[model samples]
Target: MLDEIVASRDAAGAALTAEVDAVIEAANAMSDRFRAGGRLLAFGRGEAAADAAHVAVEFTHPVIVGKRALPALCLGGEPALLGMWGRPQDIAVGICPATGDLAAARSLGLLTVALTANEEFPEADHVLCARSADPLVAREIHITVYHLLWELVHVFQEAE
Candidate 1:
């Protein structure tokens, strides 16, 4: 049991480490959008919907003291409403997206991000794959990725 737990943690760490550069790039872009008056809109289906809500809360109500609360909304995985509310400078985040919503958001001029366990996720401005076959492990990885994004977005803003 201990070995399995360690392996899962290691896998998630390796996946994130491999994608560190991508995360940093995405964070920089996200920071730019926020600076230009963009809000973050997160969505997902089924179990992932909970994660979307969590992301929204994390941004809108920062857990860390001194971290500014950013504007964010959870769309409950509604694709149509994303189009309705998304603006040119807003950020669209899709959790375990299985639809073309991210691509659609991109077309609408919003910066799009997709977090998934699928080997082939739909095209988006930023796609972060958890690289785990197990759903539990993937979920863990996805959670970490979003936390990193939330933290790094602030880091970029502070640096500027």
Candidate 2:
């Protein structure tokens, strides 16, 4: 089982590397949107939501020595709001409404970035698109995505 897990990880890593250019490009686009006075919003369910929140906090408060604060928000942070929304999918849409919501309207200038393990959600301007092979693999991909996002944000910030 351990060997199989290691082999799976190795395969995932190889596949991920093959798609690095596309990932970097997507990250760059996201960074551009964010630099233009747009907020990077992350949303997911359960553990994925926790991962989203973790990434959001990292951007809001960079641990890196010289990195500056970048605007990032997680839609699942408020338990009351989540409870009202009922599901992660609903919250994703609610947070970045197509129209109607005053807060969403106010945040129109901000770029809405969505991170989800669920590919069904249509609100995501940029989707991380997690591989559904194994739980551990999914987690690792999320971590990679966050790290890439951070690097991209820094690049965008520096170019300003």
Candidate 3:
């Protein structure tokens, strides 16, 4: 099982390298939006939701001990919000509802970045499409995508 995981990871890395430019472009776009006083919002379902939460926490609290804060949000933060508000077909609506407890957060201005294996949210400012070949592979790709996005945000913030 371990060997299979390693092999899959290796294959994912290779495939990701081939699409490096697209990844970079997506990251840069997201970074730009984030740097513009726009909070980064991420959401997914099940394990994907867990991944989104992990990505959000990484930005909110850097693991590097001492680092500047980066503004980010996980849509699943409030269970009530998730339950009461119907999921939006588009990410913009999901993250920027006019009413509800999240209205205050949305008023602050946020850019929604949806990470999904499905192409459901077309209106998302930035969508990191998870590779659906394998669950492990998708997780690996999502992690890489998150890191690239964080790096891009760092650079963009530094430049400002």
Candidate 4:
């Protein structure tokens, strides 16, 4: 069990390393949007929904000192109404897998993102693939990814 856990961590590190630069770029873009008064809208299904809420909370109230509290909302249901509240400058992060809202986000001119294990996810301005089929491993990787996002976006915000 210990060896399996170690191997899973290794796999997550390798996958995330390949995507780090893109992740940082996306974070910068998100920071830019936030600076322009754009909020973040995240959503997912079942387990991912919890992460969506978590992401929103993290951005809205960062633990990191001096990190601004960016506006964020997690849509749990009734995705059809997203456009009503969503704005062109907002950012949307679709967690775990696509629930069919990325397209709507794009149509609304919002920045779009998809975080999933599949190579084919909702088309988005950014796609951060967790690259793990195992749920436990994916969760671990996701925690790291979002933590980095929260921290790094602060860096970009400070730079701006």
Q: Tell me the whole-model lDDT of each prediction, alpha carbons only.
A: 0.89, 0.56, 0.56, 0.81
Number of clashes recorded per candidate: 0, 0, 0, 0
Better of 2 and 4 by lDDT: 4
lDDT of 1 at 19: 90
Query: What is the per-residue lDDT of model 2 for residues 1-160, given as tens digits with 9 covering 90 to 100?
Result: 9999888878767766775765676667666655555555555555666776776788889888899887766776443343333322221212212222223422333333443344444434444545446776867876776787678768766887
**Candidate with the greatest lDDT versus the true structure:** 1
Q: Which digits, one per residue and each the tens of the lDDT, describe model 1 over residues 47-159?
A: 99999999999999999999999999999868567788999999999998876768778888999888888757656888888988878888999999999999999999999
State the lDDT of candidate 4 residue by residue for 89-145, as single tens digits: 998877775557677778999988777777576467888888887877887777788
Off by over 4 Å in 3: 1-7, 77-112, 118-121
lDDT assessment of candidate 2: 0.56
Worst 10 residues of 2 by lDDT: 88-97
lDDT of 3 by residue, 17-102 (tens): 77677667666665666555545555545556676677778788877654667766676534234333323221221321122433
What is the Å distance of residue 150 in model 3 from its true position? 0.7
Q: Provide the lowest-lDDT 10-residue window in model 3.
A: 89-98
TM-score versus the correct structure, for each prediction = 0.93, 0.70, 0.65, 0.91
